[model samples]
Target: MIQQFRRFCAGLIVSLSAFGGFAGAAENADLLLSGPLFPAIETFHLENGMQVGVVPDARATFVTHMVWYRVGAADEASGKSGIAHFLEHLLFKGTEKFPGNAIDRTVKAVGGNHNAFTSHDYTGYFQKVTREHLPLMMEIEADRMMNVDFNAADVDVERQVVLEERARGIETSPRAQLSAAMDLALFKNHPYRRPIIGWRNEIESLNVDEIREFYERFYTPANAILIVAGNVTLDEVKSLAGKVYAPLQNRAPAYQPERPQEPDELRMRQVITVRDPKITNESITITFRVPSFRTGLPGENEAIDMLSEILSGTTRSRIYRDMVIDRQIATSAGAYAGSGARDDTTFALYATPKGEVTLEEMEKELFAAIDRIARDGVTSDELDRARKRLFANAIYAQDSASGLANILGRTLIVGNRLEDIRSWPDRLRAITPAQIQAVAAKFFDPDKAVIGLLRRPIDFETASLKKDPA
Candidate 1:
């Protein structure tokens, strides 16, 4: 297992190890192990306002070309929810230069792959292909950047797909339902409260012109990030981009409208419960609104990242060890810090009870664990372990070209600097126990939290047995 993990990282790394322009060399071992992630990545901007990040990894044969637009579900016009996501589906339908799925078919013909996704803060598209096909990828992407051509019929077809997706993903799944409810509770005024997939009724109402208008508004050179990662150099990528992307004009506003901010004070704590007949596992989630990397003070985001690692990043982590192994009240327990968003992010804790343990029992233990961490702070040993675990994960993530591109693109689009990503190791290492405790005590206030319980209907087991008994 260890060897396989290394292989994946190394395979991914062979591409990423080149980010620092080091490639895989015995001479660079110490630097590779100790230095910042992507130590040598090159970032620049076109005259047209498109930002570019180039990570050259010669160990890999192909490059992962990614274009990230600084727009997503949160940026949608009010009542036009899901239009951002809906447009992601339609972009592939056609473009003026390469219409009718020609771009996708062309990539496959060359044994390459392509896909796109939309999120709360951004939308992105990527393709992986050999060096020889790099310019081809750039050409088609640049074409679509300004020239997506979808008809009304295409919009109708894709709208139904989005609606069905919401039905299948949000309405039918208890977990998704719980998450949506929690977000609505956690973010009262901020657009973050809106689901990325949009509300079902709004999705149904989304029209063709809305999709076209949204695409034209947000898909500008200024609002996009072009990331080229793999066995390629800055000069090669720059040369190709100069030909393909340089001519594109910026059509977006000089400044995007500011997102609505969450109020300074949260007046109440919210507890939401969702009981689904199909749910077999009962779990509770406690989420607190916290500052994202962009909004956090110096060392705040890093400390939160460390706090989450110490809490439940591994099986040996505090929450897991205490709840699942020592107390034996939970089948699973963990906490995560969402430090990546453009605005405020989240720090969440969740646990599933073992056997007949009540959600109330699990909730009590979970909150106590968080309280203990906030009050006592982590020991030096715990701090050391967490730093190592987080650093190791960072190292592993750096081994893939696509992974490097994702980290670079996502960080850039969310109003964070490239140095913020490159300096992650040093920042993570610099975090102290007191800093972690400070964020813990500060963000996890009960008055500002959202708690969710998802479980089977009250008599689900009884009903199941009554219906199936022989």
Candidate 2:
């Protein structure tokens, strides 16, 4: 049973290890992994300024369509915190052709799933269904593009729903509280500090007209990108897009508001801690202010990604092996970097304290691991293993059309080009251990980092979970 569990964990590591530049060269092509994430992706613009990216895959049967709007929580004005997310919910309420639940009912009737998400830099809606339903998906999305409407009743109802959602998703969780406070310390004046869900006070003030104005402002064809991946041709998607989205004239503003930059003094450091009975083990996370894929140097972004993987991509990774297994201080350890945001990115590492292991000790050990990387740099063997896992996962991701589609959509929304996707594998191979260490030494400075803790109160007892018993 132990060996079986280890095998299962090993398989997950092989399959799930991935990064922004994960895709690799085709099979038997000298490189370790298989073909590119999307071998051929064609992009074109409609007359109304909607950008469309089509990735053709013969192996895929169904199609995945994603529409990315260039506005999200950060775009909301000072007073209207949650309006962007509220508008996202309201969009589904109804339109002239597809009234309340009509669009959802149709998609369900066709046996498809559809949903939307609001993020710090963008809002997106995605649907995956049969190839025959592609036209209907585009048509309904195009309809909502210009025709969504809501009455007073709908507005009040959704407002309450959004508020209730906030209570469930954020307010009730101690970890969420720590995250919010940590960001507040991390970004200072930057809009990224504002929670994606907005504050309860601000959300209460969100009304129909406010959301309508915001919708009219940012929800234009020019400010959106459409990504379609499936067993389909570029010409078919282009023809369908021309028939549906071509007529939408650009109504969005010509100038985007330049968000306030994080002050250099934001180069400062701080710590935040939250306590709750619900949380037993002490949780600690260290976050650094980093650069996004577009904002950072080309090789630098990929290097940061590689650095994260080498630090803790799996159970065999440095932090887990050291802090969790060898030191027996932390019950769990992991690290990840988000390279998709527009203005900046965040690279964070987190761990939970094992029984009788103080949070302070765990924090010290975590930094010590980071310090070792900066001082000695990584070995070629470690780098090679990390790259292999990365390359392998990229090959595996090819089997999912929606996953490829998401890569294209997220890449474009964060201000990268289509060619970036094509060149991902090449760029990743170019990242050296020196480059990884460079990011480590540069971004891991204590001055520019934020540390957050989900500390447990004295006498708090952890639930039925062990601390690296293996």
Candidate 3:
């Protein structure tokens, strides 16, 4: 199965903050700093240039084996918009050795589950099985990594699946339509503007040759990372990987992402309106282009993260309290700063009005809330509370071994070092109130914003009639 598009542990970051654990924040930080973020993560490389990370946890008997390819939709050729994701679907068709549906049946017969996902920066496939079946999973994944075979017929069938997936996920959903519009307006030249699933026309035009070329070029040991987390030691993983994955040779030169860079001065504030008859409840979203962790200054990304938490990370957050609890104009409101991309990323605020409130009213309130923070800055209490919650969330994230695997894979694939991941706790704790206010004032400018509106066509007609009284 192709998992939904999610960057980092966005759900974990937001949902875990509301739990009570402030007293232990400092203690947890001290404990984590005493060693690696989690216990015993041993990483090494094969002669074929494949990097492997082994995280040993003996609490459970199951193991999660993941292979991450360091290429994604952002690395596609100019006209080949959807090739990265389309190839993801095709990889499951079959390999010459595994044959048709053999891998799927083999994993399921053992009561294991498997899935794959594609993002702007990487694509990954993972399977979870018991320790006894770990070697089998590795052999299957290793086989397909080099020997994935597909015909024109397979390509056609999977292309239809990809198209239907796009329809079910994006075409029929009003919010998805609005999000697509916002991306098109938000990014002027960067490939981030393209949908990860791809545009409909471009997807229809893709052929088997293009996909085969892509697979041969990028799907090599040199361009991939293997992450195994569960009941296994570094020595065991090293032995199994040496036997199974070591023989695979690199087909291409070392992986180097030649993605076109976003211009330094790409600034604009635009409105994107998406009206569909299916939309009964209207909403508004505002997105601002901000520096990602890979591109920002020393403390910029951390400050943006703190600012997001203080603004609307939970029901008790500033925007939600002001709109839903105090002013009573919105039913829901929140904010997110996506700082994990390879290039510049987004900071977004969204609101759905309560009863008969107009988008204009909600937009004004949202802008006012942000402007107030930019001007007055956050109080010491708010800063302390936000930092504690974030710190607690970081500690809680280590509970799942698979979750740690995901964090490691996403961070490393985007050109970050493991030390950066280990040092994030201290860096986030050190963020000051002035720094948060400075980023809020700097990136939340009117000129760098993209406002998205989703409404029913009937609402537009009604508003037009009221404005002119015709």
Q: Assess candidate 1 and give its lDDT.
A: 0.79
For residues 1-470, what per-residue lDDT tens digits would candidate 1 score against the true structure? 00111111111212222233222242334344587667768899988989999988888788999998888888998999988888888888989888887988999999999998877788889999988999999998998899888688998888888788888888899988888888888888988888888898888888888788888888889888899999998999888898899998888853364898988775368999999888888899998888777788999977877787788767788999989999898999988766677778667899999988999998888888888989999998888766665555556656777787877776777777777766776776688989989988988887777899997776767888999996
TM-score of each: 0.90, 0.90, 0.93
Each candidate structure's count of clashing pairs = 5, 0, 0
| Decoy 3 TM-score against native | 0.93
lDDT of each residue in 175-281, candidate 3, tens digit only: 88888788877787888888888899999999998899999999999899999999898999999999999999889866788777667587788888988888878
Order the numbered candidates by TM-score, best leading: 3, 1, 2
lDDT of 3: 0.81
TM-score of 2: 0.90
Measured by TM-score, the strongest candidate is 3
Candidate 2 lDDT over residue span 1-470, tens digit each: 00111111111111234433433432322264434445677899887778899989889878998898888788889989988788888888879999989989988899998998777777888888999999999988988888988677898998889889889878999987887887788788888888888999998887778888888889889889999999899999989999889987777753264798887765777888888888867789988888766678768877877787888877778999888898788889978777666776577888898888777777788787778888999998888777776766676666777877876776777567877766667777788889888888888887767889887665423332354334
Whole-model Cα lDDT of every candidate shown, in order:
0.79, 0.77, 0.81
> How well does candidate 1 score on lDDT at residue 83?
86
Error of 1 at 70 (Å): 0.7
Q: What TM-score should be assigned to candidate 1?
A: 0.90
